[model samples]
Target: MNDSARAKPLPTPETQHYWDGAAAGELRLQRCQACSKAYFPPRPFCPACGSRGVRVFAASGKATLYSYIINHRAAPGFTAPYAIAVVQLAEGPRLMTNIIDCPQTPEALVLDMALEVAFQKLDDTITLPVFRPAGA
Candidate 1:
């Protein structure tokens, strides 16, 4: 990880499991046991049905390119001309992430392109899940 890396997310009690899973190289999500709806940005209660009975499970780590912007200005912990993107996960949730291991250009980043998770170990306790073209 670079010294200028962006600020890391602080893990709270409700969201710690997700961070732990990321550190362990797994993308974890909370599913409402009652509603069976999978969600992201972990919360204490299910957004779909107001169920407190939620279970944390590993996600398939598959997604498709939904949206993006090629940033030309440098930002904290990142270089200029990088792609900031949103991926629609196979589990029916969308996540904001950086698209990695590919050219940061419009022609290279096609809409609905297949992606697979790649963990970038930022530190000892935090590993961010980024994506790259599947099998690329």
Candidate 2:
């Protein structure tokens, strides 16, 4: 599918840094300074302690395949048989993404399989952080 046909992300002030990091080939996440907990879906306040002291930093880009589902039905921007996955980042946060560079099958996408971040640039401003086998 073409880039224009894909559903793009709308970057907000709270999440702008994340999108920027993806464009730079780095996976960035927010950590609560007060609680020292890493989290996804960036926000000004820490969800654990309600503290507004949150810092954005580069993630290790290392993750594991926590869970996934193979979608047989195609969407506007996605092809069928794609794995919609939840990857657990090394820092303790999980994010929904697509698994690429591998066959989309249950036997192939094993739970706890090592994976790493792979950016998919949808446009000049929107780059998605997908995942693939760690060494692939």
Candidate 3:
């Protein structure tokens, strides 16, 4: 498996904006106008209030590692070991992403570690938002 196969993204009508933002080297999140709550996995309406007044905005690309699990088994196109993490963005949304550019070991994946976004372009249309140790 190649990077292209591993880089496939799930895009829905509601998430097209997010994928577009990633393509442009930007991180975007959806905010509800009614409740002013920022959320991830962009949806058609606000999850908190069920309002359709959701807007997309760019994020600061700063986050902290909330939790993670190290996978030693290699999946198709994935390396033998990698860290799949849930990162808490500075904007208050938690996103499920992969942590990159560091040793994928329990000793290196410290909880609450600060991280920054690093875009990995898989192909012409897809880009992945991976995180690395902040300032590394």
Candidate 4:
């Protein structure tokens, strides 16, 4: 596959902080000052209470394997049998991401397994935050 086939995240004003944090090797999330709830996939307002009083904070790069599927069919720029996962972050939010640095099998992709962030730079300005078994 060519680089053009790879899907890249475009940073918008609401999500620019997220992309910038990824580029700087940090996991930035927004917390509502009104209700003290933190959320992800960056939004202009707090998802919890619809409050505009949100603040960006760095999150620990810790998460647990929530759920996943082993995709055995090739698609776009990905190889077959890759795990598409939803990881529950320590900060109370879940993200859909790909697991890396381990065998893509049920035995290896255990639910509730500990994970840490791993950034894969797609270009000069875009970095994807994948996860791997923590300490692997």
Q: Candidate 4: list runs displaced more than 4 Å.
A: none
lDDT of 4 at 23: 91
Model 2, position 124: C-alpha lDDT score: 88
Q: Give per-residue lDDT, candidate 1, residue 121.
A: 89
Error of 3 at 127 (Å): 0.4
RMSD of 2: 0.9
- Give the distance in Å from residue 3's predicted Cα in candidate 3 to where it truly belongs: 2.7
For model 4, residues 1-136, the per-residue Cα lDDT tens digits are: 5666978888988899999988999889889999999898899799879999999999998999999999988778888878999999999999999999999999999999999988888888998888999999
Error of 4 at 21 (Å): 0.7
Specify the highest-lDDT model's number: 2
Question: Model 4 shows how many backbone clashes?
Answer: 0
Cα-based lDDT for every prediction: 0.92, 0.92, 0.89, 0.91
Q: Estimate each model's TM-score.
A: 0.95, 0.96, 0.93, 0.96
- On residues 1-136, what C-alpha lDDT tens digit does candidate 1 reach at each position? 2555688988999989988998998999989999999998899899999999999999999999999999998688887898999999999999999888899999999999999988998888888999999998
Clashing pairs in 3: none
lDDT of 2 at 19: 94
User: Clash number for every model?
Assistant: 2, 0, 0, 0
In model 2, residue pairs whose N, Cα or C atoms come closer than 3 Å (at least 3 residues apart or on different chains), thus clashing, are: none
Weakest ten-residue segment in model 1 by summed lDDT? 1-10
